[model samples]
Target: MKKQIMLAVSLALAGLSAPAFADGSGFIRVEAGRADVDIRADGIGNGSDDDTAFGVRGGYWFNPNIAVEGFYSRYYSASYNDGFDTYDVKLHGVGVGLVAKKNFGGNHTGFFVGGRAGVARGVATVEFDGSLEDAEASSAKPYFGVSAGYDFSETFGLSVNYDRLKSGGDGVDVTAETLTLGAELRF
Candidate 1:
């Protein structure tokens, strides 16, 4: 379903008659950055750990501030180490968002902001001694975030954003907050 939505969006973009080569028009963007997770538990007490995450976001601007976007992320090495045992945890998700800007000048620099909503999922396992215990999580969640940046040219720039992830599945429910410093590629 996600793939289909992306494919359809891509096809639509491909079909869009390229807008005049104006300063504030249509363009596509790609981003990568550092991430972290905040795990929330109800019955799964204080026996867990977390590691850093990495993600990518892509957006297409219809104007300076508003565009359609999609994002995917993965958290690494998140787990818990018991006195003599260890548990493993992992998280993955994808979402769609909106991009809007405050500038309409046809320049190469500006500030922007927007919002997003989509589904997210996670998985976990317990590593006891030499054996493995299975646990999994999946959910259809809504996520949102904010961003600010400075464009270097018509095709290069930098930005930063922070987001809170709310998702639950199986017997596990978690929330995470992350700050990212990333590069943007515009086309």
Candidate 2:
């Protein structure tokens, strides 16, 4: 279903007439940074933790102002200790969305903000008295973020962004936040 949606979007983008300001370039972006997951459970205590996270995205600009993007992210595992027990949690997701950007300065060096919605899966494990138990859940969630980049020359650029993924389960609530530095190549 996700692949179908992305293909449809790609075909649609391919068929559109180019806008006056269109760059007519497709770009790929890869990012890596820190991820923080906050957990809340009924019987389990609340805890906040951090780990490594990364993402990759491909997009095409319909014009200088609007674009569509597809992305996949892996938010690394986070471990929490509550004095007597320990918990380990991990999350990953894939999504597609739109971006609205404003190009300023010289050569379209500026910022952008976008929103993405898709499915995410979370796995959590608890260890107590040397015994381990695990629970998992899946959900549809939304992610929002902002980025700033400089288009050096025409085909290459660098960017930094922050994204927050809202995810959870019946008794466990998890939110993953990440800060990423990425390189974009357009062709």
Candidate 3:
């Protein structure tokens, strides 16, 4: 299922690239930030809830005001150690979405605000510390985000983004809120 989702997104992004290249509006972005994670399970209590997070995004602008984007992000990883047993879990996602942008000065450069909504395949992996036992769960969920940024020029920019994401399975549930600083380059 994960493989299928990834392949579909890759093909879609590849198909969208041609028009972007012709119009000089394709973009790639890299971001790093902190994620605050929340975990709930049938038998386990909460542990640490913060971690370092990072992501990569690629997209093509359909026009000056809208774009289709694809992204992969590692939201969080956490571990809990009880007196006798230990549990570890990791969460990540891949998704495709649409973004609507409004530049404050009516130009590509300067202040911009945007909103994005999409469907993501979220995966959670859990492992027992002392035993070689592990399990995996995945589900499709809706994810969304908002962004505010400064575009230094048409080719380079910076932004701050906030995203809400979720994933879970069996008895384990995971949700995360991420704050990131990103740099974008247009080609």
- TM-score of each candidate structure, all chains considered together: 0.71, 0.73, 0.83
Taking the tens digit of each residue's C-alpha lDDT, what string does model 1 give over 1-187? 6577667767976876756234344344444455555555667564334556667777666655566677777754555677776676667677765655554335746655545554444443334545655666666566777777777676776777777676666566766666676676777
- The CA lDDT of each predicted structure is 0.61, 0.70, 0.84
In candidate 2 the C-alpha lDDT for residue 118 amounts to 37
Model 3 Cα RMSD, Å?
2.9
For candidate 3, give the lDDT of residue 9: 65
Ranking by lDDT: 3, 2, 1
Best-fitting candidate, scored by TM-score: 3
Worst 10 residues of 2 by lDDT: 112-121
Candidate 3, residue 155: lDDT: 82
Name the better of 2 and 3 by TM-score: 3
Candidate 2: misplaced stretches above 4 Å? 1-23, 78-88, 109-134
